[model samples]
Target chain A: MIKAENLYFRYTEGEAETPFALNGVNLEIKEGEFVVIIGHNGSGKSTLSKLMNGIHTPTEGRIVIDGIDTSNEDQIWEIRKRAGMVFQNPDNQLVATIVEEDVAFGPENLGLPSEEIRHRVDEALDTVHMSAYKRKAPHHLSGGQKQRVAIAGILAMKPKCIIFDEPTAMLDPSGRKEVVQTIEHLNKNEKITVIHITHYMDEAIHADRVLVMDRGKIVMEGTPKQVFSKVDELRALGLDVPQVTLVSHKLKTMGYAVSDENLTVDELVAELCRLS
Target chain B: MSIIIKALTHIYDKGTPNETVALDHIDLEIASGEFVGLIGHTGSGKSTLIQQMNGLLKPTAGDIIVNNLEITKGLELPKKQRKKYAAERKKQLIEVRKKVGLVFQYPEYQLFEETVEKDIAFGPQNLGLVESHVKQRVMDAMALVGMDYETYKDKSPFELSGGQKRRVAIAGVLAMKPDVLILDEPTAGLDPQGRDEILGQLKTLHDQEQLTVIIVSHSMEDMAKIANRLIVMNQGKVVLDGTPKDVFKEIETLEAIGLAVPQISYLIRALNEKGFALPDDIITVQGAIDAIQNVLEKRAK
Candidate 1:
């Protein structure tokens, strides 16, 4: 539901010699597609996410969200409503002390009726499996729980897609799993579009497609299996493949008859099982 | 340089409704020249335990001895006796802090000086070192963290990249020349390359200087690569303590507590379960590759 045409963004205002944060990025995401973007720091993936939600307008080109042009000044609010964003820090996104109130904050700003806002808040909390914590304070929750609450807040706004920018970077391992699973569930069952940016390679294994960015450009794009099979290229770009993928690639290089496209442990195990 | 803890318990907001035990009755001993990895979930008392090492937070009831200096139960004396021993207590805490340097999470935010050199020189300057000695320590610390002294000394820390800013903040701690270095989530938000660079420098420093290094990290791969021992904490308790292999072998228990083993360990276990005969103890990708090659060679024979 997001489209970008020749997206170019730069931080310097008048310095033409300064490097662009995003240089010549052209992308399209169909409705309900789960896309993951991976890159090293300063790779401009975060810049791309902010552009999708209209947080940063392109300096040279344009981005259109669902038919709403992000560069248009008046439609910025409508664009944000159509595509919500959940940032890395949940504490920054949380607006209210109470959990349910924070979820209701979005609809309340949308000027919905009180009954409607309440209904949407409850439904959103239930969708994230956080109904039991509806009345608890946001600070008392774990990192994963806080992120889920932040997602619920976005859901209450009824966005067609959600952009997660390193949502698990600050969390522990289990917190990362919880947030990743929640994102997957949103895409699979809820039919919401997802654009996840992260440094964790394992989280990208199940994505519908993966985009590899480097030095402000979309260097690679393909299905998870198609992209992750090139282990050395990804490493050269300062990105990592899944551990299983790396192991399988190493075996294939050694002429072990193992499939190089294995992205998960079970798949690699099955591949080696047939070999012996 | 050695740290010994006995019956440590830390409670936040004590005697109130919000009273929560951040650290339970925990006991740990970290010898000098050892590399230790602390792993835990959010609110697992890992940070609390590290802060205790540097005397940043006092325990409610416990005894902590750092290089034979008892830090607990001294600052909490009654009002009259507390005043009587304030000077002695200050001296001991300063000595403890000098011996143990802590690089907090998001340490780059703690950088306040005007230039990179000034920021790195802050600790040594505070330690009352002479001007020439402070400059020497700053240069040495910068080199240790893989930053060039001449190139970055005059530059503002804010103008540098995220990884560079992080190195400068770490150099600020290293300038103190502590016997023990503790960092919390040093690689939290850095990219794979940045993470590798920072961990590589820590490993080198540990080897060359024989500095006691304790790092709290969530990346099991990093811990597996660098740490000689791993300590897993959960709900204010030390649930497991052993080598990376021993701790990661309890994968089920770790998962149940919101922690995870390295991804290679999962692969090895799954392969073994599927009758591939791969060794279940392998936790690194290279180790798994070697094990798989050995198994395949035997099968071909």
Candidate 2:
């Protein structure tokens, strides 16, 4: 569970004279939900994710993760332990070269017992379906495998929520699919709340909820269908609707009696069939 | 302008312990003015193959004939004869490089000039153009890529937006006025608008300039939209080479090679399997819509 009350954040000096990165943002994410945040560069989406994970303290308002106020420095480590963060580049976040050692790094830093750390590493790797690569070097694996290993490292901490900040931005399409599918599995099977920040509209299609941000605020928030239906608005904000949505929109504009509500190919086909 | 390869094999570090075969004994021909989409997973030797076409990398064995010039054979000649052949080859290479421009992945990393004008002029200037001719080519390239030359010419390339920066990087390659432009993942890190803008500019260039375009990407939707032919590579071998419709029809083989069909094609295949009258070769969204219209008309009849 995550709650934000008028979250205002600014990456600036002492006074509020400078501009805020996130301005007057209010959001609530339920436990065991998969929420995708999308926006163009500098739309405060990445800043929102950082605030959710306690990476940055809010400037003007409050953020509470599972009843733990992020403002309290004493509870920062505990909050971070509960909400793990995975960055864009897996190579940057991985602390050790060996896969198993890298997975154990998080638990070791958490000051868990040695036996508990070993157990956590094994369980985490197994959860990510990376147990077979435990003995290999992180550099030797594919981009998707490396990212999965990074997720396993985070899962070793046994976090309740995971915030992925453009996790697949550096990966190829296959690698992107691997990371997306792996996150979907984790959210479904483990019931771990997922906050995925991405620029890709396709990657956000299956999320339980979608949040579109722009100019330091949450401009739109709804289910994928609800949010994606505002194709013109998203395009005006420099974001893109899915290709199928664009085609359907074009057809509708040409007076083809096509449904604007269609997001996927199957829906588009069914709608076209009905029209005919 | 066509390129022909005969039994081309490239082995990295021959006779060494870490020797690996990057390219097999392959034979292929690329006709002039063909828009080919090269799709492969990373490390599938696609990059290696492209580099060899431009003489950026010499093959360990076999030969490459570009526009009837035997490039690989000239490397094996004796010193004096090689010097004469090298001089002739240099002329041929310059002509080839002028006709074939390569924009590597992360081409923005190659931008290192103080001003956009000078940066874009680098390619044409290297082609031994006069100052005025180079300036004209720079402006032409800038306009071709949808950049306002008047506004961007004096500014630092570092200050432009990401899309503009990518365009400037592309204009640098375009200034050479290449007949064949090879781009590797040109839309890799761009946002949707940026990606569309770049793709649109490339498409316009392909149409107006009649430039032969080779785009190496893994996005099936992108290939489906623009490419006339798709060349699928898996583990240093050409697994499939055909039109987008033809290549996507073999969904099972594509999946087996760790490549995904475009979402529209996948849906069409699924519908066809579920006893719908949809066509199997629907690769694009528009194509799928057309197929569905035909099926619906058939159902109505």
Candidate 3:
């Protein structure tokens, strides 16, 4: 579980008129819930991710991770353990040459026993479907494989929640699917809370809740159906919804009696059929 | 000028145990004015092929002849004349490469000059253009990429945002006025709006300047929108090359190779499978809307 109260962050530019990266934000995530945060480039999404993991403390607020305050310098390690993060670039997160070693790196640092580290590494690799690649070099793996390994590294830490900051941005379509599906599986089957930040609207289709951030604030928050139904609003914010949702909205605007709650292709098609 | 490839083969770390046949005798062509999209799984030889196209990477066993100049081959300079020959080849290669500018992925990181105007003027200045000509090119390139010349000229390259930095980096290449502009994932790290802005600029450049734009990207939506032609690579082979519709039609083939068709195509297929009888050939959201309308009209009939 994660909660933020009046979170505000600002980069110290020489000029006092520098804009805030995040300003007066409040958000809460329930345990085992899957949440996706979407926004434009300068919308403080990445800054929020860093703040959640205590990499960067909030400039003027508090973020509590599972009762551990992010501002508490002594509990920084504990907060990171509870809320692990996977970054945008696959090459950057992976710190080891071998797949299993990278996954075990976190557990090793936690000073877990050797046996426990090995066991956790294997389980994590199995969860990401990278067990066969346990001995391969990270450089030899594809972008998707490297990202899965990164997720496994986070999983080995046994975090209560994992925050992925644009994990699929650098991958090919196949790579993106592999990483997204892995995260979804961890959320659904493993019951690990997931906070995914992405620019890909289609990836948000199955999220339990979606948060739209703009200019360092939470502009919109709802279920995928609730959020994507307002396609024009998303467009006005320079954001987008899934293609099916966009088409459904277009039809409704064109005087067609299509349902607005259609987020997926199947749902949209069924809406069309019922209207006909 | 047209770009031609004949049995182009690039082998990485050749003669060693790690010899990789990156490109396996690939053949291709790009007319003077055409927009092409390259799609593939990781390590599918897409980058290898593109580098060879711009004469950046030489082929191991084949040749790429650009504008009637057989690049890096067929010129057997003797050891004594090698110095003179090398200088001549370097000058000619510069001329050839200037006509075919290649922008690597995340091109913004390539910017190094202190001012935006100087960075954009780097390529033309290197080509030994006069100061006045270079200044004209710097302003023209800035305008072409949708940047204000007077506003961004004195600004440092590092001061810009991710999207703006990328545009500035692109203008540096655009200043060269290449016949063919090949960009590798020009919108890799950009947000939706930034991606649209960059793609829009590329579309305008291709249309007005008659620039041959080849975009190497993984986004099916982007390729579907802009590229008149699409090239799909797999396992060091030109697996598919055709129009966007033609290339995206083989959904199973693409999926098998870890590539994907546009999301609209999936919607149409799902509808047909569910007995809605929607047309299966829909590729874009606009096309899907028209198809759904037709289905509704048919039901009324």
TM-score of each: 0.98, 0.88, 0.96
Candidate order, lDDT descending: 1, 3, 2
Tens-digit per-residue lDDT, B239-278, candidate 3? 9999988787799999999999988988878788777776
lDDT for residue A62 in candidate 3, whole number 0-100: 92
- Greater TM-score among 1 and 3 belongs to 1
The CAPRI quality class of candidate 2 comes to acceptable
Residue A211 of model 1 has an lDDT of 96
TM accuracy, model 2: 0.88
C-alpha lDDT of residue B271 in model 1: 77
Model 2: per-residue lDDT, tens digit, A1-276? 899999999887676466788999999999999999998877898889899878899998999998999999999989999999998876788779799999999899889999999999999999989999999989878888999999999999999999999998778778888999999998999999999998788988899999998889999999998898888999999898887787677777766777776678788767765665
lDDT of 3 at B251: 92
What value of lDDT does candidate 1 attain over all alpha carbons?
A: 0.92
TM-score winner among the candidates? 1
Candidate 2 lDDT by residue in tens digits, B1-301: 7888887888888999968788887687888888899998877788898998888888877788888877776665666776767677777777777778899987887899999999999877877889999999999999999988888899999877677888899999999888889998898777777888898988998888888899998778889999999988887778899999899888888888778888887677656765676768778777866766567568778
For model 3, residues A1-276, the per-residue Cα lDDT tens digits are 999999998877566757899988999999999999999999999999999999988888899999988999999999899899999999888888889999999999999999999999999999999999999999999999999999999999999999999999999998999999999999999999999999999899889999999999999999989998888888888887778888888888888888777887778877776776
In model 2, which regions exceed 4 Å deviation? A9-21, A54-60, A68-76, A242-276, B13-17, B74-95, B124-134
Q: What is the C-alpha DockQ of each candidate?
A: 0.84, 0.41, 0.79
Best of the candidates, DockQ: 1
Calculate candidate 2's fnat: 0.38
